[model samples]
Target chain A: MTGQEPPKNPHGDDGPNPPDTGMGMTAVAYLLSGMLVWGGIGWLVDHWVGTRGIFAGLGAVLGMAGGVYLIVRRLGA
Target chain B: MAVQSMVLADVPFPPSVEDFYLPSILPWGEHDNYWFTKITALVWLSAALIIIFFLVAYRKPQLVPSKRQWLAESLYGFVRNNIAIEMIGPAGVRFAPYLTTLFTFILLNNFWGIVPLIQISPNSHIAFPAFLAVISYVMFIWVGIRHHGFVKYFKNSLIPPAPWFILPLLIPIEFFSNFLVRPFSLAVRLFANMFAGHMLLLVFTLGGFAMLNANAWFLPFSIVSWAMTIALTFLEFLVICLQAYVFTVLTASYVQGALADEH
Candidate 1:
């Protein structure tokens, strides 16, 4: 995110280029996880409530919050 | 009296899908259906067009490079250096071929959705997106387990270090979300957007036609519907490109994650 970019990592003895995403893989991973959380909750809620609209509305709010929380926690660590 | 009054009735312009439905084009015979019925032909045609453009533009492959060569090189360079290297690191160079092929394929198929007459996107078909997602799903999972043993990879994905109490809740969520939900969401996101977008366009475009043919009074509303249909067409182009990029970016990210240290 900074204007200053880090030098690229050197290749490992095993082959070439280490397995890091520079920003770390967590950014992308968290986004995917967030989507999954929203989708899963929506699906489950729809099944239980027998209403698609209510399921999506509530599910999105809860899913996004959970997703952000998990991502921040991971990043902080 | 009923017939005259019915003509003026507010039949909220019929949906767009009916106007552009396959029915209109279906009667055109084998030549017409060739582009629409088979998905791969559209993809192949798109890819062929790209290849021809590049080849024609850069036949000399000059060191200084002409404008066309520059454009071609820039595309290859952007995908190669920016997306692939950024996602998979320098080691990703080895996989550049696969990544390039994917980016080109998806980008072309997506563009098909807005290509005027040949307006259907191959990715709109659930089967195609599902196939791509499955490949990515298998690729990452296979790489993860192959590099680290199966038990270790599964443990790595599920049991990232956390407070002991939190682990209980996180484990099930992480396992299901990553293993079960990842592929499904990946497929559905692209599928749902294209499906819905195409349906909307169909409703507006087709409904307008159906209404227009019905009566003179119906023409004005049909015209408004057609305008909206055209706007949605433009929006659809953006969605197609964005979805393709998202799919590829997410794939690269997943692959990167598999290669990273598990925590």
Candidate 2:
């Protein structure tokens, strides 16, 4: 913690390296898991309530949005 | 055209998934025991090779390093300095041995795909990557729990620094992302890459042979296919190294994230 400075962008721009943030695959994973988990829950609720597939679709959209937001927050930090 | 069609019928051009499902060398029942496959053998071989390599390479220490010792040291240094240190800061030193082992183990197995006799990487099977991913996932969780108490780690991970009202929404998203997604993607990425690369090599090599037997007119095209196969072999060599490095770096980053006081 004391010895090394935080990583800087190799291009000399004020950005973190893609690998440093662990964005590339982890981001994709987050997005996918979000959709699957939330959407699955939604589907179960839909089945119970006998509503059409609407809630599942809504859940997927919400999940995607939440996933992206989470990625932004983590990477930006 | 008739001659071409006739010759083409004699040669199998495209290899299918069946081509990859090679028979086990031992007379073990194939479908009965999932572990009794050629891929399993390769996995054992890779593990043995890694153990033997380091043992032989570092048996003697000298003031001036020998070639074997130098190679071993450089590889260790690369992962220690570049990946673990860069990702985890000063605290990275303790994690270097684990990261180095992960890097070299993966690198050697992935490289076995291009080796003359061993044309298939064990990692082309999903099980190998999934196994590695599970180990990594467990390690990061253990590290996080050790650093901050188990309850605190879960609280920090799931409940992001957000409004109280948003906790319900954020908790599920964060939990799924951190726990479910991380290991799943790690396994899929490695498996998919190796699987596709091996399939592509199979196609080009087999296609060349098929084309050569198809017709005299197709002989030149066969040469082209073979040349492409050779070129892709070199590309796969680069990919093998890159994938190993990428896997090691990501694992280190996860460890770093776990150890961080602040998200």
Candidate 3:
């Protein structure tokens, strides 16, 4: 993924460039929010179910996955 | 003589975080309040300087720009062309004034850290950045709501076009990322940068002073400490300007996201 070439413009047309400078920061914001929101929910569920911290861990993993998905959908487009 | 007194002093020579906690200038009285603090005064001073600068620069319209007019125009042009237009497309023209004001205000206040007497950035206090972030937050939300009606905007924001079953999981993530994270990160970034930068300057400067009080054999090393202080000051100058630019650009990006048609 690190070495991948810039993808060719599928439209084969040169147009105004999309703003890419702030994309990395935006991606980070999305990732952090994802973890916090879902992880909080999971912690609450774990408390209710009388489990240890397992649900919070699971929520963080799922949140990260969701965050990546959102980043890909927004920036990849 | 001052160096001799400092050397003979029976206490620590270096400064501490308490040095940043300046006492309020005004004595407690009928008119005095917590709001009338040094940082508050500096904030007002920065605002006044920005207003006076442009007023003096553009008092006379010039077919061929004067030096002051050229400088003012260039600052405005940079924000308008590079940040506003680059981030939000043609529609960003309307936001040029606000972004330009924010950039200059932040840039001047950050630069205050290096000034001789006023040696701290107001933004080192989180309250300042938090206030600015809240303004940006309101602005983007207002823009989104205006562009898309109230119901449509929230619907588009929280409910990304995903399969129905997945939305239960996705909605929380989307809502958090959009509403909560945006402003929190914005405020923290500026506050942390300014706070760390000022603290670093304090460490080096105080270290140099402390070294000056060492024995005659060790006194020469103070030169090295002072040299490092000077070098760090130059680096801090770049950080001061760069942080201002970053804050403005991120703001424009958030505004762009809100105005975007897609989720």
Instruction: For candidate 2, give the lDDT of residue B118.
Output: 82
Clashing pairs in 1: A11-A17, B15-B203, B16-B202, B16-B203, B16-B204, B17-B202, B17-B203, B18-B206, B19-B206, B20-B206
lDDT of 3 by residue, B1-263 (tens): 88667555644445665655667667643233455667778999999999999999889958688888888988988888777777777777789899999999999999998887778989999999999999999999999899988988888777777678777877888888888888888899899988988888777766666665565565568677778878888898999999999999989888887777754
What is the lDDT of every predicted structure here?
0.68, 0.80, 0.80
Candidate 2 Cα errors over 4 Å, as ranges: A1-19, B1-13, B28-37
Q: Report residue A67 deviation for candidate 2 (angstroms).
A: 2.0
Give the C-alpha miss distance for residue B92 in model 1, angstroms: 3.3
Question: Please, what are the lDDT tens digits per residue for candidate 2 over residues B45-159?
Answer: 9899999988998899666788888888878777877887777776777898999999999998898889977889989988889999999999999999999899888887887
- Predicted complex 1: CAPRI docking category: incorrect
The C-alpha interface RMSD of every prediction is: 7.6, 6.7, 10.0
How well does each candidate reproduce the native contacts, as fnat? 0.05, 0.23, 0.25
All-Cα superposition RMSD per candidate: 7.8, 4.8, 6.1
> DockQ for all models, in order?
0.12, 0.25, 0.20
